[model samples]
Target: MHLVIGGAYQGKLEYAKEKFNIKDEDVFTCTESGDLPQGSKCLYRLELFTLSCVRRGIDPCGAFSDIGAWSGCVIICEDIFCGVVPLDPLAREWREATGRLLNKLSPEACSVTRIFCGIPQKLK
Candidate 1:
């Protein structure tokens, strides 16, 4: 699995598409709803997945226990924990959840990249 992270509007998805050769059909946009699609090759907006998990009282890390199920997958997550801590309790929990999730994924990922101003910086 590969991990890509950056702030909003950082072009992480475009870079992932070029680097991973991911097609539109293979991409899944995560929102504050439903379960993660195990079949998708590229998972976009993974921060939202954490939010969904927090909202539904689910464990994001547990959902990804089977690393083998995500082999060759390209995962994109927004860097929302960089700024001031959110005042809202749920948002703060979401940020912490996403941070933990990324911490787990980064070391396991075959590659980790951070996009800034449309430029890709390899982090792993």
Candidate 2:
């Protein structure tokens, strides 16, 4: 599976559709709400839901695992940083969350990949 990610308005979804020759229905948009740009298959608003759960200290591992299982084409958009930050607490937490989710779904057959717009940063 391919994970296409970008900031808001970066055109990642459009790029994916064009590059892969996939129709709007073939792509799944996982955003804040069930609503998405017209002509998209927004199955689940995972970002908002996950943020809500995480903020409340609720375990979202199961949700991430489920998404991994069900999604063959995913687009993770908004809120992802693309710079070499001077490491801070919030960044650390984000890294931890990303790591935990990846670990939980590591064995899944899908090919996990990330697409970012702009100059790539070394995420050491």
Candidate 3:
């Protein structure tokens, strides 16, 4: 499974659909009220609240990263949350989680993955 996570209106879902050719029916919007869709191997709009605690430096009891590890899913978390100040506890936690996930996935991949922080169009 390939996960693409982002805030509302960030185009993460759209990019996944377009870039990966995923159908609408294949997308599962994880929410407190909605049950996980049947046979939906892919999750689309995962509730931000599920991961919001990490932003506050409080880790969620069971996070998607844990699920991803078990399921061998590739997760792409984009602009999930950003901090105004450098060296913030929340920022450190986020970085640590990301690093752990990446290391778990492939520790030998030494190439740097550049993260562009700018207007989306600037990517082109």
Off by over 4 Å in 2: 20-22, 25-46, 66-68, 77-95, 102-109, 116-124
Q: Put down candidate 2 lDDT per residue, 1-124, tens digits, no spaces.
A: 4444445565555655665577766655444223333333332223544454455565556555445444554434344444565377644555456446545544452443343564232221
Q: Write the per-residue lDDT of candidate 1 for residues 51-118, one digit (tens) a residue.
A: 99999999899878998898779999999977998999999999999999999899899999999999
Per-model TM against the reference: 0.97, 0.49, 0.44
Highest TM-score among the candidates is held by which one? 1
Which is the leading candidate under lDDT? 1
Better of 2 and 3 by lDDT: 2
Q: Score candidate 1 by lDDT.
A: 0.92
What do the candidate models score in CA lDDT, each in turn?
Answer: 0.92, 0.47, 0.45
Off by over 4 Å in 1: none
**Candidate 3 accuracy as TM-score:** 0.44
Query: Which 10 consecutive positions of candidate 3 have the poorest summed lDDT?
Result: 110-119
